[model samples]
Target: MKKPLLIDLDGVLRIGKEPSPHVEKFFDLINTLQIPSCILSNSTLSTTNDVRQFFEFNGIQTKIPILTAVEAAAMYARLRYRRVAVYCTDHVKSLFRGLLDYENPQAIIIGDYGKRWDFETLNYIFRKVREGAELIAMHKKRTWKTAEDGILLDVGPFVVAIEYATKKEATIIGKPSELYFASALSLFNLELHDPFIMIGDDLETDIEPAKKLGAETIFFNSEKGFTQEAILKANPDYVVNNLEDVIKILKEKF
Candidate 1:
């Protein structure tokens, strides 16, 4: 049987609001070949359905479900905490539903707040943690590539700052967490021994962790800041320049 494919969204399918030129074709090929795949992201800015809508609007008709760090965080919060304080964007905040209670929260969830992150906000979150709120970090990505703005700061820096102030480490609910990968695989009834491929850009969060889960990796070198030495350290099964090249690999390998 052909291996299932797990693909990262940022720096792979689209950057910022712009999908890559090869995106539509890539999705079509996946559908045509009947490849069992999932669009996985550590992004907290959008939900799985929102990603689906974005892809459809960009002309890629896909039935592929998304697995995001936000979803994982939300799932965890539902089982663990009843009331929580969200230090994320409005869209991400909505994922928590009834659990969101900034007044008196049991946990403080951190995600990408972009410009919303400032002295007052950070201090407030710090105080909350100091007051005994459990710190829940969504993901720790350092930076992300954009279609227009190039590289932008991700939530990692701020998450670390909160940790520094509170002296309490957050329970990470995203990539590099074995639970996230194991959960995704279990949903599809897959085992670690099954032939699988992971195509992503981030080495720490995407490549290395996926490898630990026994997935053969294909590092998509989406030009932000990757040195040859870095690539050597990653040592993926394949290195492809663009999404088009990834299509060829699927045809040849799968």
Candidate 2:
């Protein structure tokens, strides 16, 4: 069995507020095999612990902790900058409480800013970065899942917009971010090359990044199968339709 499995939350195991079917079975596999695993998500809508609690309440329970982009940002922000300007929902912004600096900040931490992504607000953040504040994006994921809207534009688009206007790059601290991946693996006492696998929905942020770390990646596509070109582009070790299919792959490969 894999020492630790890195799993993404949204789209991979759940969409919006609903947990995907067989999510409990997925956790059961890890537990039955005595494999260590943790939940990882790019969304900063809640703290890692909050996400875990949500999972337990919804039907999945795991002793393992969640590795969230917000927590990663909080850790990095505490060490790197004393004062920073943050852009995200109220729940997410709470992660940066003591470190926030609205005026003349040292860095600008951005996440799912939701309805405040208009031109005027973006330009205001641009002004901060232009004046020498570093940009720390939670993640560059392109889409966000919603119960009502299905999939919609996510923070990646807005972050890119600000980057273009300011001619500055953001330091991402979530999925696909090497440091973030490394940080999650560390919790399991596993290094980059250790025996592990990543199971997630996003080709770019989930499967692609795990491949970069030299770990086996299982791409969780929605339809019956992924395009051959998409398969070649992602080069995922395996692709499955849902989390339930992972049981067979683990039995075969691990």
**Top lDDT model:** 1
lDDT of 1 by residue, 85-109 (tens): 9877887788888888988999999
Model 1 global lDDT (CA atoms, 0 to 1): 0.85
State model 2's lDDT. 0.83
Error of 1 at 103 (Å): 2.7
Candidate 2: minimum summed lDDT over ten consecutive residues — where?
A: 222-231
lDDT of 1 at 187: 58
Q: What residue runs in model 1 are displaced by over 4 Å at the alpha carbon?
A: 147-149, 191-195
Residue-wise lDDT of candidate 2 within 1-254, one digit each (tens)?
35588888887777667888888887887778777788898888888778878887986787766888988998999999999988888887888888888887999999888766788778888999999999999999888767676667888998898899889989999878888888988987777767678898888888887887788888888642447798789888887887778888876755
Instruction: Per model, state how many residue pairs clash.
Output: 0, 0
Worst 10 residues of 1 by lDDT: 186-195
Best by TM-score: 2
Residue pairs clashing in model 2 are: none
